[model samples]
Target chain A: MKGIYFLVILALVTAVDIIVPYFFIGGIASLAACYLFWSALTFAVIVFAIIYTSQWGRRS
Target chain B: MKPLYVWIAMLGWTAIALWIAAAARKKMRPGASEFFIGGRRLRGFVSGMTYAATTYSAFMLVGLVGLTYRLGVGALGFEMTYLIFTVLLLITFGPRFWIVGNWYGHITPPELLAHRYKNQWVAVIAAAISFFMLIPYASAQLMGMGFLVDGITGGSIPFMIGVFIMAGLSGFSALYAGMRSVAWTDAFQAVTMMATSIIALLFTLYHFFGSPAMFAAEAARKTPELLKFTWTPELFIGLSLPWAFFALTNPQVSQRMYIPDSVVSLRRMVIYFSLFGFLYTIISTLFGLEAAIVIPGLENPDKAMPHLLGKVPVMLGVIIFVGIFAAATSTLGSIILTLSSLFARDIAKHFYPEIPENTERWLGRIVILLLLGACIVFAWFQPGLITVISSMASGGLLVMAPAIIAAFFWRRATAAGALVSMGLGGVITAVMYLANIYPLGWWPSVWGGAITLLLFAGVSLVTTPPDDADRFISSVERELVARGFRRH
Candidate 1:
């Protein structure tokens, strides 16, 4: 169940990561804000990956 | 861009790499296992470095930078999607592969599939697909060197000489002590690659625009289109989907699961590779974005990196050249070494069961020489389609993903299922890519993967599985718990 739950979250995050940047805030005229939003999303994914996998090998 | 500087950088980089290979020969023990996989005893750091070096190639610095230059923020999304999916997939499958590999003493990725399927043909088929797909990919690395040197020196070094120089060094690095030398040199080159690129990036940022903030502002002001996210969903999925499964589909990286010394080492390999990949992706993509601002109006987007180097200080430019060379050479060396192991263990030994281990080891070395020769010919006569071929390499290899995942997870998977899916799906995918045939705006990888999943599942249901499937699954399950992983 935990494994399935983790995979679900991974799938959702991946969908959001790909979908949002290209559709929602990507075409805005404000370059700095748009770039920052995209950059922040990428950093969030990286941080989440680090945190998620850090506990992958730990005893549950 | 002088002949002298190009020669100095190329020669100096080769000498240092060869010296590292020679030094690694002293630490390696006698035997094929030691030669092929460092006796399966590599510590976390070395294992991690080799993984990082093997996975991230010259493609990142040259091809990826070009993509980002031509495309925009969408390039970052495509690349980052790969990283995110790879890290997630690694967390899920890394332990499974490690435990199974350690338990069975599997020497190659194909061997694991062969063992699980209890069929020699599975290994042979997988190796054949890898050899076919990766050679063009490897040739692209050499072509990268040729392009870099030729562009830097204005053709004074000659493209052939540049290709041969990198080929000779790459061949030596792999042939010296096999994986031991390759891993050690890769670690060295990996560090060299990152450090030099970081320095170059900072130099460009500070020297040109005064700071990263300034660089971004200038880029946004100058070429606002390059800062926008404009990649179509089809284009994004087309490029990213294959790489999303890269950690599983590409044997050069998948085989690393068998090299780490323990579960802890395996963990470190994943963590270190993730962080390294994270930082490197940022650097490479940022360099691409910066290149657009500083050196705009280039006719060929692929020449962006070379043009950027031409604009920087000569000393820094020379250092950057060596760094890009290190990137290509490390990639070529690792690919050659891994392919040699695949040929030796999976294809050759499977055909000749009575062949001695000593003969098998020699066979691997011999294959390295031949593979390098093939790659040189391919690179020298460099096809104009190198980029297309390289892009399609991972996409074609995606045909293997369904089969690979089914190995550990799907008990109903049969040898016949794996064979037909990989062989037929790989053929269809390659053909579709080459013919520029996209079905309804979908990439060949998307089509191939969909077809492969259907074939794998459909064929697996009707075909009889090997009798050992239950035992194989149960053993891995039991070992996962024993290795401190909870199933739930």
Candidate 2:
């Protein structure tokens, strides 16, 4: 909800974004699944941030 | 290939865009700042839509599609990383930019920097750097339009014609009502881009492969190499690093931070842009993946989208081409308008204190025309060195990140420090890029960012801080608190 929390989420999402692809170069089926999942996960983090930030905006 | 359909789509789209511009002109006010920043009265939706339109250009559908087609899942990760960083940056600094912009009535981002650091040279140098760096990039957007048209028309229409048409249309968009017209058209174009791309993507999936799952299966079965994440760490970082800080570095989008009418609107701007970016990134990257399955072993990766278009129905292909045109025009128009503001406010008006505001507005319009002309020439010439410049554009801009970030967060930052870091760092990165020298197997952006941050910090620590460093930072903070942003 706050800047620090937002920053933490940013770092986590970015790390996953990089590390997952680097380490999980699996076979075709697994790789397709990984790409979709990782992409969705990264966007979901931003969606959460937007919700939190707007709530914070309203409260402030 | 139904070149006629492409022409018809473009003509119809241009008519609609011009009508929007005419409508925008009716509401326009006088003066350079009003024209450039829409008098800073944009609503949240318009603000968000224009920001999204400007930030996600033809590159998403064309360049990015090609990148994804070539590199695999790494393209998605790289793009998603940019989105994530942008959202976080907006949440953190968007408020600060809005508060300071309101307090000072700043017209351009560089002007804000000059004010914070209390140095005219800062604004001048920053504007000059923007001028030098953004023109070729803008021209490339026009070049993109040319290539798309040329390819779609099968050489019936030449490349220069595409360049001219785009240059003329974008120039008109900027010349009409400045930011107001550009923003209105951008909102329209942004919608067109998403809708057309989505329809095409779904059609590609259902018509060609029966379903999303089927398409994925086919892709996995045939071009599994694309699904596999085989990007080297060096490749990934080089490509993604500059883009991660794009929110702060690229003035076209960064200037949007000053446009929202209220704190709530600014918040909505971030939320809306983030959502649009999220959907659009997925769509573009998926298009890239689909291209791999649909058309394999293309000689040029960048040709993936064009090749895919050839296989689609004529009407759908033309509509998608129009979307790409919309994307490129919206971006080109915004960049021209923003850069004109930079020239008029930070460079021209600074030296000519006696110039009237009305004259300043006219100056900006003239600059818009001249800028478009220059871009058209560059795009038409199609020089060999442009490849290097195009490759270096993001990283070159990345050199400004430390200076901008420090301007808001670090009170000890001096004008000299900001200037040196941006100037030296930009040159160093550009030289290394041009010389084909990547130290340590890392990208220029990584090296540029590291050096810029260190230089900014080291220089600021030894130099004299701006006399009002504490006042500027605290007052902005106080304003942020008043606007509802929490402070620890």
Report clashes for each candidate as comma-separated counts. Answer: 0, 0
The parts of candidate 2 lying over 4 Å away from their true place are A1-7, A25-32, A56-60, B383-391
List TM-score per model, in order: 0.96, 0.96
- Going through the candidates in order, the fraction of native interface contacts each one reproduces equals 0.30, 0.44
How high is the TM-score of chain B in model 1?
A: 0.98
In order, the first chain's TM-score in every candidate is 0.51, 0.57
Tens-place lDDT per residue, model 2, B74-174, is: 78877888888888889888888888888889889998899988998888878887887788888878877777787777788888888888888899999
Off by over 4 Å in 1: A1-6, A29-46, A52-60, B385-387
> What are the per-residue Cα lDDT tens digits for candidate 1 across B105-141?
7878999899999899999999999998999999999
Question: What is the lDDT for B139 in model 1?
Answer: 92
The Cα error of candidate 1 at residue B30, in Å, is 2.5
CA lDDT, every model vs. true structure:
0.83, 0.83
**Which whole-number lDDT from 0 to 100 does residue B435 have in model 1?**
89
Best-performing candidate as measured by DockQ: 2
Q: Model 1 clash pairs?
A: none
